[model samples]
Target chain A: MYKLICKDGNAKRGEFTTVHGKIQTPVFMNVGTAAAIKGAVSTMDLQEIGTQVELSNTYHLHVRPGDEVVKKLGGLHKFMVWDKPILTDSGGFQVFSLAGLRKIKEEGVYFNSHIDGKKIFMGPEESMRIQSNLASTIAMAFDECPPHPATREYMEDSVARTTRWLLRCKNEMNRLNTLEDTINKHQMLFGINQGGTYTDIRVEHAKRISELDLDGYALGGLAVGESHSEMYRIIEETVPYLPEAKPTYLMGVGTPANILEAVERGVDFFDCVYPARNGRHGHAYTNHGKMNLLNAKYELDDRPIEEGCGCPVCKNYSRGYIRHLLKAKEMLGLRFLVTHNLYFYNKMMEEIREAIENQNFASYKKKKLEGFAAEQGN
Target chain B: MYKLICKDGNAKRGEFTTVHGKIQTPVFMNVGTAAAIKGAVSTMDLQEIGTQVELSNTYHLHVRPGDEVVKKLGGLHKFMVWDKPILTDSGGFQVFSLAGLRKIKEEGVYFNSHIDGKKIFMGPEESMRIQSNLASTIAMAFDECPPHPATREYMEDSVARTTRWLLRCKNEMNRLNTLEDTINKHQMLFGINQGGTYTDIRVEHAKRISELDLDGYALGGLAVGESHSEMYRIIEETVPYLPEAKPTYLMGVGTPANILEAVERGVDFFDCVYPARNGRHGHAYTNHGKMNLLNAKYELDDRPIEEGCGCPVCKNYSRGYIRHLLKAKEMLGLRFLVTHNLYFYNKMMEEIREAIENQNFASYKKKKLEGFAAEQGN
Candidate 1:
């Protein structure tokens, strides 16, 4: 399913084939957490912005529509009408971060739903079953994402339980694939590596998960309140131990610069909600840096979000018009900025892949990062 | 500027030439009050849904971006990036409906801005000058939209003042259109007729306005707390007095049935916020009737919002999917429904135009109204 096309130092260009479609490596999965981009961006708009894969949340969908309901209606792809590669994260991250805590037993965790505070328990088997019903191209393992600044003892214990959860998740997914009513019978399971910010623990966890021969691997606990240098160092220490044949994903991992740095560290897939979230608050990411639409300088500026951006929004809309919409609390403002930012990220990935193929990724990453860090003009 | 092609009884098929573009008669002008559709629909999306004319509010734009800001950035057509003809209503409606305190005098009206509570005064000349800054294809005259249940004595004085305002609006518009810096040098003026629900007052006002030979005329103060039959009676009584060479407009109106009945009564142009507004609340107008997505019956229904409808939303999305998004408070739900409802309305107008061309408007109106009033099924 995973094919490495070329390598330039540690920056690899590759493609992964899923049942839905083929995804180029060094790709960004547009986040549509509750089956829609938070800022009124539809899947149709996603297509216009060069989106390859859409990432959805297991917790939100399972709680609102229920996995059973989604299964009955077809699947997440059909539900959202996104006929592309879709990766669904295990409810683990949301369960740990959003839900009200109760207890974490050897089997799973018990908590209240963040939406309504209703009692709910999610074990590895339950998580796998929900993903099975969602029937996404990739289903992540139900692993506990330990917070940063954890002691070695807690890290060791969490990593061990995560391993056990991976085994259970893999076993359950295998069973669900053979069921007659399963939406995506070939739904692939990916194991997650969690070690907080401990480099040695991350490397050991990576090696242990690599031994399972899963379809892919993900660094789960980085970017959870850790510094950028710490996250980059951990990725460098851990990635070499993981199998090069499978795709490497960075979970809930960040900024345009962060993606550039991670791709150089051999990570393949990434997703984040910052584009839509920031757009809703009137922030836009241009090649020269981010700018706030609320600033008075943009009130009469007639240029696009980015001068050379090829996105639909930047192609026809002006900064002044979008700024007026934002001031008036119009939804189209959020929609335009969200569409523009996602296009910026996706285009960044496209450029990254081309640079790696031409063996100039190092210079490309440096130049792009510098451009992004530079102050923007009106 | 008006060209009559044919007539099916009172319902005529024709075209009206404007500075921006030619508009098909019996048209439904999509309302973009405050410079945007209520449910995040953009000008690009408007084009895809077969929208011809876009209607904006003078009051909202004047208060927020302000007409001077728009004029500096270019006009409403340039600001919105919509090349089609735009019709901007006089600020009178919003000033009366939304502003805090207002005092009417022979010169003008004084009111506090609903947004910032700042003092503002506007009269016929001020409205025309603002609309000149907007540079829409048609600028409505500044006329009082008298409240429903108004006494005959109040209606008598209001109509006389409105007639005076109409003359001043026409004179101001002529001066602005000839100015060297005017955004649209050929901007046309549209006079409004207002008489509450009194047939005699409405007929007399219509005849008086028709004598001015304005580009278009609108029946204001209808559909404001008045019964459908009473409003229909006023249209039936007053439309004949308006010149056949000019387009007749009905302001802030109505359902599918209301539009159909008014068209047969000789109305040509229409504007309303119902489709976008009702769509935000999950009420959809289908061939059968209204469908509320909030109902649990749509939980497992995989059909489109309206089967056989060619709108973008209906073509690729399902009822179950939209229902899930609505339940989760996702914006895409409102967006999809809004797009569908607008498509339904625009398509209805297209069908109305075609039926008049085919000389079957009366039968078409009957069949459509019955379908819209029927019980919708899954």
Candidate 2:
């Protein structure tokens, strides 16, 4: 179900085939956490703006519509009307982040739903079952996302638990796939690597997960709170040990600059809420730099957000108009910014893939980073 | 420079030529009351979404940037970055609606600026001078928008004072146009008719303003607090008295159904904030009726706001996504709805013009009204 199409040094371009479609490797999955991109972007908007795989949260769907409800509605694709490859995070990150009262044991985590205080138990097997019900193209393996600044002893024990969780997730996923009632029999699993900022622990976790021979491997727990250099260091140390032929996913890794840096470090497949979040705050990423529409300087700026941006917002709207909307607390202002930012991220990834294919990833990375950082002084 | 292009019954089609551009008559001027569409739509969004002329407020601009500041920036068109013809409302309605401390007299209403509560005086000459400085394609003559249910005696005096204001406005506009310093060298004037709900007073005022030979005329003060039937009745009584060659504008007159009814009653121009305002509240206009994006039924609806809406929002987003945004308090959701609503209104006008041209307006009006009302029932 996965093929490596091209390789340049440590970087590789591949394709992951699913019922919806085949997604090109190094693809950026637009984060639609709850079957929709936050900030009012629609499925049609996503398609127009060049989104590939849409990543939904299994926990969110399970809590709201319930996986059974989505299953009844013909799974996530029909439920969201996005007939493109969709990868579902196995309720791990959200369950770790959102659940107010959680008890971790050898079996699983018992927690209360964030939506309501209903007690719920989510383990590796339950996570796999939910992903099967949703029928996603890719099902992320259940893993514990460790809290930042943990002790070395705590980090080691957590990695061991995550490894154990992976085995159960894999076994349950296989069992579900064989069931006739499962929504998707061909669902693929991507195992996640979890460790604190410790390089040795990260490599150890990566080595153990690789033994599972998952369809893809994800480097998680880095972007959580670590510095750019620290995150880069971990990826540099651990990626060479992971299977090079399989796609490397960077879970919840961010911004255009971050993505470019990660891609150069041989990481593919990313999802982040930054573009949509920053857009809602009236900031938009342009090739020139990020601009805040709420600033008074844009009040009468007749120019587009960026001179040559092809996004609908830039193609038709002036900075003055966007600023006005922002000032008035209008929703269109945020929607325009969010749409533009997502388009920018998606476009940036396309450029990165091209650079890697052409064997000039180094130059592309240098120019893109310089352009993004240059705006900081302003 | 205004031409009567076609006529079907009392309903007619015309074109008003302005220095900026020629404006198609019976056109619906999208209201951007304070140089921005109220629900946060920008000028660029307007152009792509089919806004022909943007209507700004002399009162709002004069209060915020001040007409002098806009003059420094170079007129309303340059300030707003919309090259299309723009029609600016005289500060009359705002002064009546917003001014905290106000006193109306023969010279002009004396009031405080709504924004800063600074003492400000606006007579016909002042209104003309401000509009001339702002350099809009067309400037509306200052007229007191009388309150509904006024006694016949009060209505008579108010209408008489409004006539005096119109003459002063015309004289001042002519003088300003000849001055080399004036931003708009040939600013056209559109005098307004105002006479509570008194039919006799309306006809008399319309006749007097018509004789002034202003470039266009407006039916104001209706739709303020009157029934739709009452507003239509007044239009029928007064429209015949106005010059047939010039365009007739209905200021702030209402819903999709209301516009259709008014067009059939011989009104030529219209402006309203309903589409944008309603859209911000999550209500969208569809052929089936108005769909509220905040409703729970849309929580899992993978369909667009409307199945075939050509607006960017509907073209690209699902109803479920829009609902999610609204629930999350995301501005993008509101912006999408506002953009879509404005597009719906502009498209309706285009269709209305086509129906008139094809001589099927009567049947078109019947069908549209039935559909809209039926949708509302559902």
- The residue pairs in collision within model 2 are A42-B317, A44-B316, A45-B316, A331-B331, A332-B335
DockQ of each: 0.84, 0.28
On the 0 to 100 scale, the lDDT of residue A8 in model 2 is: 67
DockQ-based CAPRI category assigned to the predicted complex of candidate 2: acceptable
CAPRI verdict (incorrect, acceptable, medium, high) for model 1: high
Model 1 regions more than 4 Å off: none
Residue-wise C-alpha lDDT for candidate 2, range A1-378, written one tens digit per residue: 778777667677777777778887688889888776775666767888889999999998888767886786678887667889899999988899998799888789999998789999999999999999999999999888889989999999988999999999999999999999888899999999988788889988888889889999999887888898888888888898788878899989888877777777788889899998888788888776787878877665677888888887788677776676566565556767888889988888788778878888888788887887775322
Worst 10 residues of 2 chain A by lDDT: A324-333
Q: What's the residue-level lDDT of A235 in candidate 2? A: 86
**Per model, how much of the real contact set is kept?**
0.81, 0.27
